[model samples]
Target: MKGLLVFFFIFILIGPIVADVPVREEQFIYSIMAFNGRDYSRTFCGENSDTIYLIADQDNFITTSKTLVYYWPITGDWKTDTRSLNYSFEGTLELTEKRRESRIIYPERYTFYNVKGEYEQNWKVAMGDEADKAWQHYQGLIDEYWQATYQYEQAKMAFDLMVDELAMKITEMRNDGIDVTGLVEKLKRLGPPESPKPPDDYIVPPMPVQSAFILNLPRGEYNICFINEDSAVMESSEKRVVVFEKRRADGIGFEVIPGDKWTRPVESKRSSSVLYVNGTTDLYLRPFFQDEYNDLYYQRMIRNDAKGNPSLMNWVYIQQVPGGRIEVTKNNHTSAILVEEPFYVEQTKGSALGYKIVPFDPEGAHKDRDPSLIAFKIPITRETSLIKFELLDNSGLNMAGSSRQVRVIIKSRWQPILLVLCLLPLLVMTVVRMIRSRKYSL
Candidate 1:
């Protein structure tokens, strides 16, 4: 009788497997945002904004091989500019039947845990089978993500470069009494560069130099040529060749003149710095560049007041903070101090939260350093603004161990989970009936 009972149990389990038809379903999401130049039209200079037409496409998608069955655009107002329009393009687009595949697995899984805090997913397939499928799916997803990201990033960089070039060209042209706006449009129409120059290339007409500026060169026996409009060359004077190395002010970008002097630097153990000022000219700052080694320095340009001009006794201020000491120095000259310890800051809306791992090891690499050093800024909203950071290990696994601190603070206004809750009883009844039907052989 015991053997018969075991046989019945095995048969019941196998029956469900035999009757099961592998139903499969899949969903994919692809998104991108690309914006180019805008175009506008105007009839008269009445400041009529109505005549302006802004033309730029954003958040567009295209499936080359498949015909879209259904798709709807989610149109909305621009978040940054209320006058501008925005299109989210977030709806799912179903492809035609011709694009449907013969076999598709349901892209879903259930999570379980043997330990109270451990999270694991159990798929319909065995361990190896699920892993292989997941690997393939994720690999494709990653490739798609990276390709889109690279293209968008390159386009953005190119646009920025073009803008900077245009700005520089406009400034130069305007200084020469030329119509800079007209030149700007002409450059835009010229578009990309061509080898050997186009047959009808629009060349910039040469303009005479109205103002000449000279740089203070080192004392040297030198041969210099200045080519003017008449191709006339003017050459040299015998200046003493004094070679005194200024060290190129190692890693400095710009120098401050007396006028742009900042306040004195403050000597402090904490993170703070101070500088004093005694000048009245424009302060120029530039980005510092170093060799292959990533050495960094801050450079300031100061313009000094001419003789008899009012002295800037307290115009400039500068400060520096290092670990625990706070040092203040005056007159636009100071040394940069390295930060020896991580700074602790409180979390606030729109402020980046800071953390540092304890028991410091200074020589460790970035990855080997304490996980606490990773910081995340809080995302702000008109509603609740909160920032959350998840600390993951080298294996992309969360380290919080289901702690209360990891909980999501904001409760979403729209609760789709409520629908699942409502249908729970129905799902339970159907599952119980299916089990009973197989067990009773009815």
Candidate 2:
């Protein structure tokens, strides 16, 4: 009876606490995403007056739509915009001045290519401004293929029926004790019709037309407003536009890939930044051409945020480049021009399994596989602590943008001994206590 009363009291006290949790409500907002050559880049709008930046001489698409947004407390990030409610707001994007208009390219046939040494896709536009004609031509080809397929199917059905009928007649004649040896020989020679091959290199036509706006303007401020059907400017549809140029275009940057952690690559943007590493380690370096721009203007251009620091500058990676050799100088004297080499990671055998990295040999072990990276192996010795790197072009000229330093910190060999010494006092105290307790009990 007492246990029951306590259980009822506990349940009554906890019920209201669980029921008071609040549920998130769905809210609608505008969404804008643009395709920047490779993939779609989303521009999140935090407020109505945020500015949106876009690169000049590129393709950009803009659409205004309503979407559901909810805050998830677990992740602390906004949930994906679901249920696209495209509210019809008939308007025209009005710019202050006439920007460079994009050329309407009607690619009849296009081929995709991987950009050399860069993470971008290059599309080769072929036969421009005849999209309708190309669509009609491809439609005609599809119809012809369909007709051929249909005719082949009908002919195959008819052949199968005739073969079945002949076999039935032969069976009937055989039951009647009539000679059908010559007919059987002819039937053996007549096999089923072969399937027709599809048309060679048939490529489906792409989009009928592609339109883009080229934003090639000088460094200045601009405004873009949407004029509604009533010819009135939409208050929330107005967005600020800033056109800025790169500060410097001839800077070289590096994507530093550590041997221990390759996925978490660090960028060496400026020439004076020092890369610190502990003990002997292998480093894979990928050089890139970078440009500097204002942080506020650049960030606002990429995302629609009301708060941005206009005073700071940031480096933007343009593309990766080759034909450069890296020179590693240790302690300002011992230096070596490091060339690109292949490496292989071999897994260890037995109970204590591990991985061992060695110089890759294409003709021997790694014949079937390609080298993971074209890297320079730097063995950090204990005596040589400070190291600096200089990038040189193929003609043996120093690359001003690729100069950086590496500082090595020697690992302490007495760390294990120190840890043991610290734990010895505790172990001795524990043993003494045990000994004292035994002596007292006795």
- Give per-model TM-scores: 0.17, 0.60
User: What ranges in model 2 sit over 4 Å off?
Assistant: 1-40, 46-49, 56-59, 71-84, 87-90, 97-216, 305-308, 345-357, 410-442
lDDT of each: 0.28, 0.64
**How much is the lDDT of residue 283 in candidate 1?**
24
Task: Give the number of the best model, judged by TM-score.
Answer: 2
lDDT of 2: 0.64
lDDT of 2 by residue, 373-396 (tens): 666666665577898888888898
- Model 1, 352-392: lDDT tens digits are 54322232344654334443221122112323222122223
Cα distance off (Å), candidate 2, residue 398: 1.3
Root mean square deviation (Cα) for candidate 1: 37.7
Give each model's clash number. Answer: 51, 1
Worst 10 residues of 1 by lDDT: 297-306
